[model samples]
Target chain A: MFDKAYSGKRLDRDDALALFNSDDLFGMGKAASFIAENLHGKKVYYTRNRHINPTNVCVNRCKFCAFSRSAGEDGAYAMTIGEILARLAATSSPFSELHIVGGLHPDWPFSYYLDMISEIKKAYPRIQIKAFTAVEIDHFTKLSGLGLRGTLSELKSRGLDMLPGGGAEIFDSNVRGRLCPEKIPAARWLEVHEAAHTLGIKTNATMLYGHIETYEDRVDHLMALRALQERTGGFQAFIPLSYQPISGAIDVTRYPSGIDDLKTMAVSRLVLDNFPHIKAYWIMLGEKICQTALYFGATDIDGTVVEEKIAHSAGASSAEMLTTGEMINLITKAQKEPVERNATYEEVSI
Target chain B: MRLALHPERVVTFIVDRNINYTNVCVNKCSFCAFYKDEGDEEAYIIDEGVLMEKIRETISLGGTQILMQGGLHPALDLSYYTSMLQKIKKEFTINVHGFSPPEIAYMAAKAGLTVRDTLAALKDAGLDSIPGGGAEILSDRVRSAISPRKINTAAWLQVMREAHLLGMRTTATMMFGTIETPEDIAAHLEAVWRLQAETGGFTAFIPWTFQPGGSPLGRTAGHATAADYLRVLALCRLYLDNVDNIQASWVTQGIKTAQVALRFGANDFGSTMIEENVVKAAGVAFMVTKNDIINAIRSSGFKPAQRDTFYNVLNYF
Candidate 1:
């Protein structure tokens, strides 16, 4: 049944088990490469924009996050529309898109965020505002007492360009329960994103790996996203975030291999064959590894982050503010010419 | 492999742009597939004008920094390094996060200078920070097998030590699961531990597995499993007690395993690297838009924060 469900070409359970159990590292790599070659030719893509975290102050302090804050920490504060626009203006880089996400702020009204996007468009009419995660949308719904589609539509109408994929840690409820008791369940996260996609807003997908989750959970996470993508075809990309166990709930001293940094990237390229782009995300992986990863299957990297916060508070390594040249140098070294992209992935040069 | 995320809570960025200033290298490592020989078609080292043009385009599209790395050629001594860095810095307030330790060691060796002196020279030239590139595996055995021409483990540590000692905090990296053992990995951490204890110089510890694409370590060359990568990544967090940040190696592992890694010991989701190339020459291909990263992180139940080289938080949104 499972084989037929995945199309009549599923690896037998025995085969899957053997692959999982095999101690031969090269053998597994060959299998993955063969699968990737058969599934998708080595084509990859990227974009040029900024990651705007609206707020770090959150109620859900997951076991894996180093970016969360307790309401108001010394380094944690929510961004007002003015502050975001000011930072955006400072770059003066012809960013076609603005990637925005934030914590589940308890105090702010949902309309405030819509206003942020509306004002961004007001200031830079040409820039696309790819903002909000399902979590934020869900929070919006709870706060404003509106349905996901209604909220998403209102935002889109008010200049919210698209949805930036954010809150979807793990699909498995057990894993979700263990990692973040405060976060909306995995099902709800999916439901909200699905609702947004139904409203004609394209979105991305993601999975967090290495922590308490098992291989089955990893496969399940991919399968769920694949199932959803097959249905909606709204997912533009799939990103794999490693569980940041430092200064978070999971103590590395207690459990280390949870940070399966290398495996996550390789498998994501191999498994999410249907997803067009897989991101390396230098902020968490660091710049050098992300550059090195362009070959491993991650073709698109998130842009020149002029200013970032959540990851830093948790202890990410890379510049807080990136300039134009750094982005070009990284792509050039990878031997790939860098192209600018806007929200919805339109190439933007002018 | 996982399902499409219900993009929700985390923070992510976009893609686009790449700029490599120079490939002229005096120190060639076995793992590097990007560097070029003096006269190769891909060998021409980019000059200031060429680099400036590239930067101009990237800037035209919101590029944030230029990762300027080149060879440790004897001809390109302190003046060359400073001049090149200063040129980029002067023209634009770009983050010049360039130069591996081997390049530093080479320049230091050439200029009758210490590592600290070489770093100071570059720092004065507007270099933001150093990348942990040359510290391959922190083990001389792996060092000897791969790039004998490169500096030894001791020298790598010394360079990082000097950089840290001079107050130039940097990241520590390890390229593992290649002709190495758990003991070797542990030993690598021990070395980092000693240095971090003294200087607290490390901003993060990134452990990536080797890619055997076009290098001497071909397709048949050994590579680690996702589990192995996780084991090492998580272990680095556990053992490298001094280091605070443990990034997921999505560059090598792809996104799913990287997501899986978040549970093990990675707190940071890592960079939204707009562009990259070094690993592709070996073999690995994964890509992420800024939104994808945020969704991936948020769905995983963590608040994704966009961070910088100095570990400063930009904004919470």
Candidate 2:
């Protein structure tokens, strides 16, 4: 399997399953690192970006979600366009991207969403807006009385540069039904992303694992993303979010161990061969594990996320933010070159 | 290189139980989660009956030794240790791989004796060998920052030297991934390598990461990932060429990464650790049966063998 991966052969689902089940973690890591080095030689991409979660009042009650709150809950919040812009203006550091993702607001009209994007884009013209997940797009389609493509085009016209990958938790229907029963089904979620790709809007992909998902489910999820990426080449990166345990309907008592995190990263890098990038989202994987992941085929350590609310609400113990200096230090200490990039992964001059 | 050195393609592990005889400690190292204050209600010195029971269970389970280590209790004296060893030796024929350099140095200081005299006394009481513990990183700077009250680098090496002169074998350990630089790691390896070169008393090098879950230093240091663990494992093998064995830490890195360590230059699979407290006190535990070790090693494409405290194969599965 290592030789096959090294030879640049596409791994079938069975091969990916075998790799997942195999105990040769270092061998798999070496092969995955070889492939990563071939694609980007010792260059680990990061970004100076701020995550803007405009609201936590979500309609879908995901069992694994700790961020979403029902309307009028004590911790619930919905930011106005003016407030979001003011928050962005408060930060003095320069950033090339504005990562905007939030819950599906039940009462807000589709025009409110479009105006939020346009207003942010108008205020910060150069900062690319990578906003929304496929689930959110499906919500917007229903709200605006438009099709998935039309809704995506509308958002794109209003300055949405790309899509952030959330809500694609695990594409298996049985698990998805139990995890987020109210959210869109896997077919609709995939259809929405395919529509976004058809309209030329590149997006990222993600899978939430270590939460009641089997190796077969993980391989199926990766294969689904691989199949889509092969058809549209729209995915800019693959981020595997480790399941963080919080008090909720899902009765998880422990976080995924470091072995599971590294193996998942290596397996994703090998399975998603068409993906140009695999991110070790430091907010979710912590800094040390994220740094260690560079040698296990991760090409990105995400960015200096000014404030991360989603994972933190889910009981993530990592710091809410990292300074650009700290991000560079982490990458450099891992013996990799840190390249600051924009949302689309174009190298940004620092 | 690993295959060349381990031509037999065999991975070995010891079936032992790590028995912490006491939890009362004076050093109070920040990276350790097992130590307690002398007056704490939870602190204890193992009762002889309980200790004997543990030994009987271990012997029944095919264990050849009991890896006994404990915190540096302020009140314990040389006779306390000697009598404990004498009692255990009188009861069972099990090899007693007990005490580390720090404990020895403390015992020596409390007894108003030299390290050599203390080691000679312990050996006379039937301490077959020493298990490497409390040698977090063999750099004085790192030691002072983490465990200032413990023995210094020179003192640790001196105790090891004394034990070597007494004709006893001891293993060297490094607990890294706590505030240590690459240079500190190099210094640690150099110290162990130089000591082995001089005395040839070191039997193996066991490198495990510091589990930061329940330790005081956990707030500052994160747990080391498996990749970092493997990288350090490989580096230990490549650097400590004079050392004969490298043991993989399944306790901290879990069994999967430990299996991968076979390729990264680890020849021993560490102990079955029927009971482990230090790392578990830090809120991380990977318990494995003897069958688990054999299966893991076999699945990793190597023959699994059970060894004694001295790394001699007793049985192959």
For DockQ, the strongest prediction is 2
TM-score chain B for all models.
0.86, 0.96
Per-residue lDDT over B20-81 for candidate 2, one digit per residue giving the tens place of the 0 to 100 score: 99999999999888899989999999988888988887787788999889999999999999
lDDT of 2 by residue, A1-350 (tens): 77788888999999999998887777878998999999999999999898999999999989998889999989999999899999999977888888989998898999999999999989889999999998888988899888887888899999999998888999999999888899998888788888889898999999999888889999999999999999999999999998874534596533455667788999999989999999999888877678778888999988878888999998787888888877887788778899999999999974
lDDT of each: 0.68, 0.87
**Alpha-carbon error at B253 in model 2, in Å?**
7.6
Q: For each candidate, give its TM-score against the true structure.
A: 0.52, 0.72
Q: What is the two-chain DockQ of model 2?
A: 0.13
Error of 1 at B312 (Å): 43
DockQ of each: 0.05, 0.13
In model 1, which runs have C-alpha deviations exceeding 4 angstroms? A1-44, A72-76, A254-259, A321-324, A335-337, B1-317
List pairs with backbone clashes in candidate 2: none
